[model samples]
Target: MTIAETAAGVEQRRRLVTAIPGPASQALMDRKAAAVAGGVGTTLPVFAVRAGGGIVVDADGNHLIDLGSGIAVTTVGNSAPRVVAAVQAQVADFTHTCFMITPYESYVAVAEALNRLTPGDHAKRTALFNSGAEAVENAVKIARSFTGRPAVVVFDHAYHGRTNLTMAMTAKNMPYKNGFGPFAPEVYRAPLSYPFRDGGLDGAEAARRAIELISVQVGATNLAAMVIEPIQGEGGFVEPAPGFLSTLAAWCRESGVVFVADEVQTGFARTGDLFACEHEGVVPDLIATAKGIAGGLPLSAVTGRAEIMDAPHVGGLGGTYGGNPLACVAALAAIETIEADGLVERARQIEQRMKSRLEDLARSDPRIGDVRGRGAMLAVELVVPGTTQPDAVLTRAVAAAAHRAGVIVLTCGTDGNVLRFLPPLSISDELIDDALDVLAETFRTTTVTS
Candidate 1:
């Protein structure tokens, strides 16, 4: 199969003729407020009319620099030629024929790709789902079925999903879990090796602490799975200290606990490596992946050891829309694009550029507490000058200022003090530098009020 070329007609520069929202976007926002649910929040009220190659053109023709990559779902860029062509062909042929009932080649093709790409060379199996949350929930189900255990372990500052069980696994309270309970049961929370706030404990020591807590509180035998994000996403792009993941994986292996890597955010080429767990040479028993797995299509999967994945009954897994043919084709095209375009290397280049710029900015700004993340997925944690106290106010102010200046940035973390940068791997260096300039100016001006 041949790779598709970049889309035409969309310029790759930031341009703002009208205000940020302009009249058209404001009108859309007004319509959205009245028609859409109030809970569906938007990072920017500007309605996008066209987007490609690091620029999202709003209704009023304002071209905004897209740094968020639609929350890391567009690592291959929106309107990726390969993905668009694949989707177009698939839609023309067939959209869906539930994999559970009438399986198609594209579905098996995507599964084969995932089984080959994910960490480890072990005999593997895969199950498709429609979202990250569905993949995660199914992973948990598989783990429990294989281990015959009831308890599942999670960590603080983790963002799994909004599903009942995942929401229970998640640590944050507001937005994700507020008034959404009661959540699932038997999901235990453990301490993560957050180097920034671990008070001097290194990765190994932090792992020891977490293992002790799990052994004492949840008991190793009762644990069905130990799920964690190699690099925590929404929880501020927190990359665990060195040796943390390896140590934890080691203990889980020795204790027969299924170690599941929640790579929903860190999977694909979003991280420098195809999988973040590859950074530490830790191969998880099960890996939940989505967001960037299928360009921008709604698809997810649980790839794991053959025995574990096959533990559930024959008809126990699957959904009505899981592994939809169109999404499968999109995923195949996306994986091909990643390989043909050398996006893995591109992600590393993005990291180098982003880190260099953000680190330089941090040198002059004390509020830029820490710069952490891997590959194209990076972030800066905001804190009070000379102290570790989170400065969420400053973070919001800077993000808002960037939005006003025609840049799309996203803030995350339990404290809402992290400004994450998940630019598409296909984005150009020039656009990245342009967005950084806006960020620098925003920080310089907004820090005073913050």
Candidate 2:
């Protein structure tokens, strides 16, 4: 199919051959080991030769269903014709002319799109960056500059990013924060409304408790921003209870603290809306976005109240390739695809299908302690029967078995017991069913470890 002719529905029917990594991918891995950095640790060994919509064709001709969406990056599907064409066209014309030096229309268009798509209609502005971490770092800088405060607050079990500042904000210690110490100071961790694990405290109560703790420890007056992920990503797919986000938003407004919603993993229609905060009717002061923003390109953005975004001195926030022409073009195409194609509603559809399937599995199997998340971003939390103890062994086994059966599955959570599904909203109903069957079969024979 030409770049212009491939449709989402037509693209999901592709099939797989040879196993995921077959000979071609193995050879590629060997070559990669020789040339690439040793820090790369892929969940699967497949070498993608071609991809479109919800399917990935490996070098060995195996077409595996993509349930992870490239770590939730390709929400519009891989190789979307419009995005591909836009990127190709932009690259041919001009690759780099740093926006800080000479601005471009594509960059402004992207920022405008973000301003409109994000919550709060009262005079919004946006700044683009190269990655989720960069967007997050800038959000903090803007908050600090605007509020003139020294401290920032994040929540427990949060996963912001890997950079020095973000690592300080990030709650996970292992892997992300280990050894990369001497983190930025004055970052505090507060409690979150994780109903599944934290007992005795509901949504509002949890928020109140968090606010009280912050007041006692950091003092809200000294806090510049309180960064949170509406749907906790790397801390596991833990969705805050109904009133947690709303309560926090109100608190931030009352205290003059900038509320930054780190929607890097849950924005751009991934969570059934352009941003997950919309689910709670909470309009954050600043919203940081990245993963799914550009349909697979490296693009991140921070959109917020005009006053707060402009607080930083002129030339205070930018990057050489922050809004690279190619990425900006891809974002425009991706946003167009999301709206024109109704990917938001499509995400809801995927959620309903997966929820129904997984709920049934949970009911039948005592191992599935909880199944949660909204829209296309959903997960199943594994636990010992009749208890809250995490069952990482069964979780690992189920994911491995699914891979063996030709479906890619990803695991997350501090305990490594949650299987998150980030399948493209454009994924077919049949493909969803097939992947579910593989999961069901995987659970049937897997043994649980305490």
Candidate 3:
């Protein structure tokens, strides 16, 4: 509301003193082109020098309202006071002795917190990792070890990660999996219950269809796990119809298949619930989480049934920097901040507020084909007015215009027509209101390019 420590007392508000990609940012981009790999594409070319609360200060000192939240990693807000303090204290004490070599209290504390917070009350154990992909890969390993199965199933419009095994689990082919294959083996795909495009199919029918396909195709007897994003992230924020997840979980339980929920994007109060699986009351055998776990620090975990997690031989899982002391402390502080701020309820309020505005926008504009998602994670699909034909050209144009106007927005969907909004819970309604206003105006002025 006032000033932020991240920017050395920079006021928390969107103030564009120069063009969005001010000269300084363009300079950095040029430098990046020569120094950094071409594969590392940028959504917003403007480089952020400082960020906190809902604002990202670019190199030219322009304050931009942050809607992306570093791709849902800063759910507790950027450089949050508690997280910063904890990391600072932890760093001064010791950076890392290697958890596997010499375990620390913070890592144990974080595991305890995740065990208590994740969906089920059933006896659970947690193992930390450095990224979402690692968490997912480990979950699969544990599941396979426990079940002695080789096959795994993932759904359409799903994004697991970019690792070799995760790439096999992921559905999209373009940026995530193009030319990078020879992906891992024994990964199968299934149909997802997409409400917007599924001919009004209900959750139960969708689940049945998917279950039958898995039965016929990747027989349950051979399947180790069914990994899914409770709400699909990069493949578009597709919330599979209500009963769909529950039915799948039940089938997995009966079939001796581990149900793995990849909550990388939807965890840590980003959705109204602490974990999106809670919304469906579906308990997963294992849940892989990363984004939003440690403010901006790289930390991920796979928490699940104790017996299954313990199935793998000792030393089968772990990394040198798996649970660095700094990251562990930051995670603890972030969890503390979320509970203290009542961020789960705040995320619900954000969902109501954002959906209200998005619905209003859709009413007047036929291009807005649908508005869906939960908590602070909302999205709008741009379409060709009368039909559900994706209008990707228009989508890209509008997002670029928003960035030019000092408002950050992201686009997803397999078709690239969905605009996702994941603002930090610490963001004020006023910032959201202003950003939406910019989006509305951008939509009004942006002409369909194709």
What TM-score would each prediction reach against the true structure? 0.98, 0.96, 0.98
TM-score of 3: 0.98
> How big is the positional error of residue 335 in model 1, measured in Å on the Cα after superposition?
0.3
Clashing pairs in 2: 16-63, 17-62
Candidates' lDDT values, in order?
0.92, 0.89, 0.93
Off by over 4 Å in 2: 1-16
Query: How many collisions per candidate?
Result: 0, 2, 0
Decoy 1 TM-score against native? 0.98
lDDT comparing candidate 2 with the true structure? 0.89
Residues 1-450 of candidate 2: C-alpha lDDT, one tens digit per residue: 232233443445435567656988999999999999987677888787677766777788777788999999999988887898899999999998999999899999998888888997789999999999999999999999999998999998899999999999988787788888999999999998988887857789899999999999999889999999999998889998889999998999999999999999999999998899999799999999998999899999999999999999998999889999899999999999999999999999999989999999999999899999999999999999999999888888889878877887899998889999999877778788888988888888887577
- Least accurate 10 contiguous residues by lDDT in model 3: 1-10
RMSD for all candidates, in order, please: 2.4, 2.4, 1.4
Worst 10 residues of 1 by lDDT: 1-10
Model 1 segments more than 4 A misplaced: 1-8, 448-450
Q: What is the C-alpha lDDT profile of model 3 across 199-232, one tens digit per residue? A: 9999999999999999999899999999989899
Q: How close is candidate 2 to the true structure, as a TM-score?
A: 0.96
